[model samples]
Target: MELFFKYLQYEKRFSPHTITSYQTDLHQFQEYLQEVYQLEDLKVADHAIIRSWVVTLVQKELDSRTIHRKIASLRSYYRFLVQRGLLETNPTLRIKAPKLAKKLPAFIPEDAFTQLLDQSEFTTDFKGQRERLILELLYGTGMRLAELTTLQLEDINLAASTLKVLGKGNKERILPLNASLINALSHYLQLRSATFPNNNSSFLFVTDKEAPLYPKYVYRVVKKYISTVSTANKNSPHVLRHSFATHLLNRGADLGAIKDLLGHASLAATQVYTHNSIEKLKAIFEKAHPKA
Candidate 1:
């Protein structure tokens, strides 16, 4: 199990968020096996046992995506064991994840973001600058929370006005930095350098103690500011990301170009934003047409 985690972290380069989810799923399944089936070893669990766990998850009314990830985590664990010749066959081979219902991504309106950035007052001090920059990078580049948290100083190319992002599955993509973001980054970098003169950490963002920006802290910072601009239920960093992609699509950005900017493995993942665009069109039509 330890080896599996190390493989995920070191070899597969899974993000902290994903690794945490996998950890929770595996632990829950292991506990279930022990209590319900009197099975101590996951390698000993058969297809029927795995199917029973899936049925239980469905009965509990877990979201399809959550149940899907749990099954995937277990399947990966067993596959790892089998690849190393520890197991004879994969028990999860016959398990099928439930179909997922389509859910449109939530995004902040463009005018709301405009008011948030232009109307809201952010101090010039290090803390204020850092918080503002967090929102800027998330919405400007559409980077994931984990990617922004793990961003290093070396990832930014001031000369080229580009940012090299290490995305999922250890893939790398370069995103163009706009003028506003570039200027904000420049000011923030100066403040960070002056404040941490003696600190040699390479992370782009840091806590007051100069430690790398952890996921929870970043989440809190985003939530705090986003709450002021919008009263939506989701005030997380991901809402900003969705805002970024949706705004771009609404403004006529090409889908393939958006895909590369977002670092999605395929167009299918990026296509979800089109639903939001269609909703926007419907909204505009209803306002313009007077016929009931």
Candidate 2:
């Protein structure tokens, strides 16, 4: 377990937030094993015991996604143990994760997106500028909120109209920016610099005190802006991301290119946006059909 955490820290180069999630998930599994199976050492755990634990998770009515993640955590730990010769075999080798249903992502309409942007521009304060930029980047570049929050001053190149985004698993991807967004970011940077001349914080977005913006702050900004323009069931940064991808897909963007732009590891991951686009097409067909 310690070696696995060290690998996450040094080799995998996982962020502190990701490392913490892995730790919490693993610790929960460990506690379950200790209490139910009286097993203190992971090396002695067997396939049957792991299967039983999965059964308990299902019985608790945990979502397939969460259960799948827990299983993944165990699989990784067992793989590490096997590679290091700490265990003779991986017990999770044949354990199957529950099948997860792919739910379509919710996104706001184009008119609503425009409305949200218009509402966000109502203020001339620093917070207002930052909030507007947050919405623009999410809808413009389709970046994850965490990626946006961690952006550094050097990550953006206005001249090239691109952003150097560090995504999940510490992977780097270059996302394009339009002239309008580039102009907004440039103006924000100037204000940010003038407000804190001696500040050395590398984050692109900062508070009035010049500290880096927290994830919750970004979430709140997204939620506030979305609430004004969208009456959709879901309103969040991820919805904006979905809207960005779905809009691109609707406009005939290649699935592979969208995958690369979103920094998704596989084509399957990016294919979810296609589902949203298909639904939109179905709605249009239903509304336009002449014969009943």
Candidate 3:
């Protein structure tokens, strides 16, 4: 299993978070096989055995999305095994994933973000600079949390006003930095260098101990600031990403351009933001258009 995971990490270029998900799902499936079927070999799993696992997942009343992801993990793993000639056939080929409802992206309004960044105050210190940079990077560049955490100082070209992001699947894309974001980056970098002058880490953001920033700590920073301005139930880092894309669409940014900035492999993944745009258009038409 570790060998398979290494293949995904090195050859497939999958991000750490994705590799972890695949690992968890496969381990769960293996545990089920051990407890229920007295089976220890996942390579020998047949369609009937895999399908029973899906049934058990549904019986447990897990969300359809969770079940869908688990099945997807199995599909990829089996496909990898088959491609390697280790498995005669992919058992997951015959299994169907649970159908999922389409959910619109959740985002804070533009004004709420404006108030958060413009009106909110932070002390003139290292911690304050770090917190502001975290929000600025997530919302400004629309980079994923993992991508932001893994950012190196060289990833940003301050003079060029561009940010090179390492997105999912280890894909790299260059995003233009707006004037405000550029200034924020500059200020944060200055403070970071001054405070951690002797630190050896080259990561753009790090803890007070001069270690690289972790995902949970970054999540807490986003949530803490997001809570100040929005009462939305979903206030995670992804809400800021959705806000970044949806706001761009509302202001007439091209979808393809948005797709590239978001580092999405497909336009279909980017189209989800359009649903929010269409809803905004409907609201405007209902308020302005008058007919007898």
Candidate 4:
């Protein structure tokens, strides 16, 4: 397990959050092996025993998604063990995770999003301007919070109205910007320049002290604005991203284009937004239909 973590960090270059999740999943599997089978170590376990362990996990009432993640972790771990000569053969090769049900992602309505942005307090003050711009960019670009926070000054092209974002797996993609976002960013940059006249930091968004903005700060700002405008659900940055994708899909945007905009690696990852759009269509049809 330790070597697997090293591989994830050094070879795979996984983000800290992903590494943490892998750790948790593998730890749970190890505990199950210890408690159920009384095994001192998993290196000597055979394929049949591993299959039974998966069946036991299913019997524990775990959701399909969680079970699937556990299976993925085990697959990686066993492959590593095989390469290192600790295991003779992979046990997870024949094991299959149950299919997960398609569930729609939660998103704020268009009107609620407008209300949330309208409720944001914009001032000439540096912090106020920075906060407003952060919210605007998240909703405008549909970028993950980590992508936004890691944005550098050179990543944004004001003249072209586009941004170069570094996404999952260290992939780089270009995302177009709307006029409204461009204007907001310009105003915020002017304020940022005034606040730090000669600073060397290249980050687009910065704190009052001229330091790079942290992810938690962005989350808190989003939470504050969301609390005032959205009463239906707990507001977060990801919800805004979901809204961006859903809104685009409803407007007849191509699935491939949406996938590119969201920086998703596969169409399957981008298809979750379609479920939300379908639910919206169903709601509209129910309201407009006159049949008894």
Candidate 5:
């Protein structure tokens, strides 16, 4: 497990959050195996044992997507072990991931985001300015929360109105910034300078003490503001990202362009936003079409 973790960290260059999730999934499976079957070694485990673990997970009422992720983690681990010659056969090769219903990504209403920015009262202090900028950047740039947290001062090009993002799998992409986002970032930079006069932090967003912004702080900030504007089922930073992409698609932005903006590895990943757009089109058609 340690060797696999090192592989993910250095060789694969996965983000810390992803590495942590892999660890948690593996640990949970190992615990289940120990508790139920007294199995201390995965080398002796077969496909039947793995299938039973999946059944146990389903019995625990875990979501299909989550169960699929856990199974994927096991498959990766076993594959790694096989490559290293430690395992004779991969136990997860035949185990199929449960079929999941196609669910559209939940995004904030476009006007709702506008209302929050225009009507909401934010403090004039540094903290308030920084928090507001964080929201703007997330929705404006459509960058992932992890990408936002790792944003550095050097990544911003104010004159060009672009932000260079380090995305999943350590892929780099440039996202153009809108006028509103640029102005907000300018105000935040001024406030940041005043708040931390002697600070030399390279990271773009920082805490009150000038430390780098962690994932939890970003989540809290997004949730606090988004809850006021939306009653979305999931109110996280990714919701803002989803809003960003959905809004673009509705406004006639090209799908391939959106795929690039979102830093999706393939067009299929970006095509999901089309589902939401189609739903909106259905609503418009029902309202406008004369046929009852």
Candidate 6:
């Protein structure tokens, strides 16, 4: 188990968040085996035992997505054990993940974002400027919340009008920026300089005390601003990312380009936005067609 974790951290280069999840899921399964079947070691467990745990998870009403992730963790761990000669066969081989219902990514509308950026009067103070920039960066770059949180000063190149994003799997991608985002960035940098002239942290976005911005702080800021412009059930940073991709798709951006900008590993991840784009087209057709 310790060797498998080291492989994940050092060899696979999985993020700490992902590593924690793997640890938690595996630990939960260990406890389940210990408590339910009085099994002290899972190395001897078989597919039937794994399937029983899946049944237990379903009976407990856990989300299918969550269950799927746990299964994935188990699969990976078992693969490691088999390769290391710790187990003979993989127990999770016959286990299949439950089919998950497809749900479109929630996004704020174009007009809502326009109103938030244009009609809204953000104060010129440090906190106000930083908050405004946070919204713009999320919507502008289509970057993930984690990407935004760890954004550093060197990642942005204002002269080139691009951002260097360290995406999933530690992959680096360059994203272009528009004039509006550049202008917002410039203003925010000015405020940041004035507020923390002797700051030590290299993070682009920081708190009032010049500390690195955390996930919850960014979530609350996004929620507060989005609430003023949208009534979407989810008012998180990823909503802005979805809005960015959806808006670009509506404006005729290519799927491959959107995928690259969003730093998605495959076109399948980017294709979800096409469904949203098609829905918009259907709405337009319904409103304009006269042959009804």
Each candidate's root-mean-square deviation in Å?
2.7, 2.9, 2.0, 4.0, 2.0, 2.4
**Cα displacement (Å) at residue 108, model 1:** 0.9
Once fitted onto the true fold, the runs of candidate 1 whose alpha carbons sit more than 4 angstroms away are 280-292
Which tens-of-lDDT digit does each residue in 1-292 have in candidate 2?
Answer: 8889999889888877677778988898889889988888877889998898899999999989989988888888898888888888999998998999777898988888887666555476677778889889999999997898899999999888899999988899999999889988987888777778899998998887788888888888888888887778678789989999989988879999999999999999988788778766787788999861
Candidate number with greatest TM-score: 5
Q: Model 3: runs farther than 4 Å from truth?
A: 283-292
Better of 2 and 3 by lDDT: 3
Number of the candidate with higher lDDT, 3 or 4: 3
Candidate 4, residue 292: the lDDT equals 15
Residues 1-292, model 1: lDDT tens digits: 8899999999888987898888999999999999999988888899999999999999999999889899999999999999999999998989889999878898999999988999778988999999899999999999999899889999999889999988998889999999999999999999998998998999999999999988888889888878888989999899999999999999989999999999999999999999989977787789998971
Clashes of each: 0, 0, 0, 0, 0, 0
Q: How does model 1 fare in lDDT?
A: 0.92
Against the reference, the lDDT scores of all candidates come to: 0.92, 0.86, 0.91, 0.84, 0.91, 0.90
Candidate 4 similarity to native, TM-score: 0.79
TM-score of 6: 0.90
- Give the backbone clash total of model 5: 0
| Model 5 alpha-carbon drift over 4 Å, by segment | 279-292
lDDT of 5 by residue, 99-147 (tens): 9977889999999999989987889999888888988999998999999
Q: Which stretches of candidate 2 lie over 4 Å from their true place?
A: 15-17, 231-233, 279-292
Better of 1 and 6 by TM-score: 1
Model 1 is weakest, by summed lDDT over 10 consecutive residues, at 283-292
Which candidate would rank higher by lDDT, 2 or 4? 2
* TM-score sort, best first: 5, 3, 1, 6, 2, 4
Q: RMSD (Cα, Å) of candidate 6?
A: 2.4
Tell me how far the alpha carbon of residue 244 in candidate 5 is from the true structure, in angstroms, after superposition: 0.7
